[model samples]
Target chain A: MTENDILEAAKQAVVAADEEKAIEVARQAVALGLDPLRVINEGFTPGMRQVGDLFERGTMFLPEVIIASEAMVAAVAILEENLPAEQKEKQAGIAVLGTIEGDVHDIGKGIVATLMRVYGFKVHDLGRDVPLQRFVDEAKSSGAQLVGSSALMTTTMVGQKQLEKLLKEAGIREQVKTMVGGAVVTQYWADKIGADAYAENAQEAVAKALELVEG
Target chain B: MTSYPTRMGDGHAVEMSTDELRCDILAGTEDAADRGRIPALSQEEQDYLLDLFSYPGKIVGVQPGNEVVLTDDGSVNALYGAQSSSGVGVPLSRELAIRVYERAFCMDTMEVGHPDYSFKPVKPIVSLEQQCLESVLSSTIIPIYYGAMPNLALYAKPDGPFGNPADLLPQGKISEARAAQEEAAQALTRDMVYVGRKMAEVGADGFNFDTTASAGDAEFMATLQAVEELAKTTELSIEVGMAAEFVLGMHGQVTYDGVRLAGLYPHEQLKLVEKAGAHLFGPVVNTNTRRSSAWNVSRAVTFVKACSEAASIPIHANVGIGVGGVPMCETPPTSMVTRASVAMVEIARVDGL
Candidate 1:
């Protein structure tokens, strides 16, 4: 198959949620001496991005996105394994993501985490209902450049502001950028809470995380 | 009061006091002998039965001629014929009652009856919680589904094609693909019914169907139908919760389709829900720091007002606060209380109170 054909096959595999097919394709690309990064950027990433778009457009639901993400993760693992240590080390940035305390809604955060991984960012997902200090501690411990918090309720979204305050109190506010998003989180609220960035959905979260780290 | 032995429908004759008979009748378990007699119950006896059934409890056992004991076993609690006291009786604020009345004509004529007399209570403005409780007691419809997250894996058919986008399309023919989608949608509805059954078993007053996770019009409608079926059997009110944006169709996000799809706009969706016999509308506002941000607060207020105006049912605005917008934690207790107070005031204002 042509390189484009191989990349297309990988994309189709992820969209099809065929983890074995995605891994097989990634393995074949590795055996063919294809650049792993090229395969990821051209193949798996696009597929996952499409999944994210489909989810946002209400054409796909959470389970589908989750399965697609699993496929991509399987493909990426195979591809990353073939890459050299130095190349593998070069990621966009480290990020700490979690649902704020008292909120168990993690689907949105999980989506962002998966998308960030596809975009070459190392993400530390703290799952749902993460403590305020743990966010700061995770960022400090992991040397993370970005911290993303999600809450599906207005009552718990206040933790985003509390996290911002805690990060500043930890004296590392300048070192880390914060991103907040959820069912109710708006960019205006993010700004009001002093978060560095806000994303409406997972796709925007990837773009914003890239900008926050690169810019 | 005279004591008498009455034969139950099961051919069992039991002796009971007038009060015991009144309790049995109020509880809707009167013996066959007295089923159609319609005995006169004092106001105190009526109120006692009304309060007993207002909260969550069930009659566990009936000591034939003596007493009917109620236990807190989470059974369906319903008041059969309690006198309705407009706002106080149903526990709703007058503004909310007015809004509900304006939208749903069925509510206004809803009779709260007793063995002696049935009267429509005057609608008085009351607190939201009291209103919800009163609505539950009077109507026996408790709204469930706030913060309810069903596990998707539980719904997926084993050995069935799911979680695969390829399965979403026809392999070679449109008919085949359509069948797959239909089956998938049916599976989703089954899951919703399962959730609804659990909610009903716990004596939910009503159910708020969560629309955030719905994939498209097909799945959304399927879930609605499933909940509607539950409501039919359980006699619980149905409330549909949608993101405020989805309801308003803001940002050009509204998808237009016929009744089958409901056009994906807020107003259209509201109409469809009403047509489907929903009793309440919950518009969920997605914003952080709901109390602090004027924009967020105003947006929520506007959305609630729009819902109230569009539908006759009571509008329940689901707004979050704090870091991730979860209402339960991390934020100070005062902040949550303040946000709730502010939201209530704003909602009341929208009702022109």
Candidate 2:
């Protein structure tokens, strides 16, 4: 198949949530001597975008989006290994994501992390029930441009504010942008907590990360 | 069941399915559109209902229609207590010094929480509940003690047998889940019984196991065990309010009274609630945030209707924000909530909201 045809096939594989097909498309792209980074950006990543659009349009559910993401991740893994050093360096930004301490609900946060990674950000997902100090430490250690915290419960959401305070105390607050999300989290809560962004869902999380990192 | 023209989560117009509302509820789109009209609602009634979305309001109300009984969990706490983060209520009462007890007497029945509203399995909260329970009990309103057995992962590792489910689920640690389910069930049941007895001693009219099975099958089993034990130990009537539409089956092997606990729908859950000796049952139908209120209500009412039909006990459907067809917003729109409430009462035939 021609390069454009192969790329288009890769995109279709992700949309179909066919993980095997995605991996095959990635390997075929590599075998045909196509740029691995281009395959991800031009093919697999756009498919993830379409998945997000379908989700926002209410045509898709969480499980489907999750599977489509998994498919894209598998294909991206194959392509990432083949990318040249110069292309590998062209990440959009580094991000740190987690569910705040005392809140074990992280499905939403996990989705955000996955979508952010698909959007070309190097994400350090801290996992659920993450401590406030951990966010500060990770931001400092990774030099991440964006740090996102999710707290599904109202009792635990206060940890996001404490995280903001901890970042400032650690002297890295100015260097990093902070985003807070979860079921109970709102734009008002984000503003009150002095966060840079508040994404309602994974799709919006990706858009917000781009604005925070590049805009 | 008939198809209803409803908005998806993004406020786009669509027709919710008749038979396939559950799938449509989750995906925020209708898969099967029978396109049958609402025979109960006249064209004018349908137009008025649909216009709730078009003409939005800060706080919407029912059209002075027939009233339905309301039962709340963690209600008063949303006003003057620590739970009231929004700070939109009357002056703080001295009785409400402790943050987590939601003692709303205004409702048909008051649902008061243990002093620690998070319902953590801590000891000090028991004494606090005992101290606060007397003031919350009223002769006019049936007072229920509300609490939850949050997922075991909320408790940290080593101290609790479970690791974070966020990590475990993706990692697929089956044995770890089995071990955690056993240990956490024991811990949660102990706490529920102890607090439940203490509150019963203080004269709570009933017990509401709010958000039970949040950790899936294991947690559901724990709640059932607690309800069984509490029923035997104290005379306090018990009600079990579920956390989600279906049991997550996190611990797929867990069971109550010979029946497997995982993946039970509302109707199935009601049987267990009854078996566990609960007088009332509140079934939760989760709303997709991206789906319109019309879709959510249609979906929520569908599940609730089935559950209610199967229920021998009163079914007080959880029509809250993000569940029971309510919009998934911080402050749910009044129009949508009222619409959902009306539908639950009319279509679902729920005993209470």
Candidate 3:
């Protein structure tokens, strides 16, 4: 079959949330002398990206995002499983993520987590209400090169800057770069707090996080 | 002075000191005594009973009698009064209370937030908290207090949108009466704890601590953790979950755009208080308490389900029912209790209490 035939099938699998079908198509495409990396870049990632967009635009809600992301992760996992040892080394670095203390709302954070996981990063999420100490503690423990702390409240957003301070005190400031986001947190605030990057939504979050970890 | 110098009931006058009555119960005369159905306790049980029940001059304070008082001067047994909510008094079971106190001394729920101490929870607000505690417990069922305070949305940003609409209220003054209103609530918690202790002592089954000032998880839970600690300390065994209204509570949130607000996520954070070991369920914040439909409590129950799923813990949930809808305080007491019991049971109704 032509390359377009395989990519369309992979895209449909996500729309239908048929992870097995998505994986099967991805597996077959790889076996058919196709480029698995191109299948991911051209097929699975684009479909899932659309899912996030639909969600942001209010055309879709959480269950849809969750389902689409699930299908995408499954297909990517299949492609990842058969990746040549040399190629796997080129994947994205890990970034530990979470919402800081007293702010337990997670829709935005969850979307970002799903986006990060489906892409290439190994994510260690600390969930919500994460105190500054826990942020420092998780970053140290995970040995992660990036920490994404998203706050949903201004009062708690202050905790994010406190997180930067704690990380510096722990002597791991240079070990991990940080990204801050949420509606109230702006690039200006990011600069003020000494955070390295800022993003507006889940996709931007993943892009910004990659920049921090890779740079 | 003896509280029961003479028997006023059909039984003839019998002089007895409060301590003597304790002895009779301890001596097992209480086992065969005439009265309504009361859980019979052995000598060991009586001693356990006296340690928590004796009304003398301590914080777990209460004069020894069948009556339960909620007070702060150490006059009667009253922890937030949520646990003793069953009206059966000492709902923790003698075994559970001993178990809880054995491992708990009210300090395990640490003050993890505010390390800078610049934003310490307003205190001797503790005194005010006591007063508000009394206001809520003054009734048998919980009462709802609509918050009158500033939310980032209500007040405008320096140049951002104001209220839900651009002009629902003036720039940064959506609820102008907030400060005065907060002081009133502050006084309520303090005064209520005093009166609530009296109410509990006089046998007002339990108290539900509802407030408008409680906003997010940390704000709500910090207050709740303190309340739970306070409840455990005074032996009042009351249940309190800060009902979250998206707009206001004493936390005095300044962020007008919640969607833009970082750190805050819509999760039922109450279920995660691993140390407080108190029966609770909330961070109920998706819908507006003032504008949402009457069935909003159900959404809160669902939110608890989600948070419980996230934490991998089982939690019971409850939402206030009142005159705003079919279930009013005026309804038969049994009806109100049945609704609350059914909702709680729906979530974590396990075999054991």
Query: Which candidate gets the maximum TM-score versus the true structure?
Result: 2
Instruction: Summarize candidate 1's per-residue lDDT along B92-150 as a digit string, tens digits.
Output: 44334433543453222121111111000111111322344344444423222211322
Docking class of 3: incorrect
User: Model 3 compared with the native: what TM-score?
Assistant: 0.40
In candidate 2 the C-alpha lDDT for residue B138 amounts to 43
lDDT of 2: 0.71
lDDT per residue (tens digit) for residues B138-215 in model 2: 423355554544445445363454564444434334466467667877877887788788878888788788878766
Candidate ranking under TM-score, highest first, comes to 2, 1, 3
lDDT of 2 at B280: 89
Q: Write the per-residue lDDT of candidate 1 for residues A1-215, one digit (tens) a residue.
A: 78898999998998777889999999999988899999999998888878766556444544455567777877888889888898866788999999989875654576578668756788898877799999999999999999999987666888999999999999999999999888656666777889989887778889889999998
Model 1 chain A, TM-score vs. native: 0.83
List, for all models, the DockQ compared with the true complex. Answer: 0.02, 0.11, 0.01
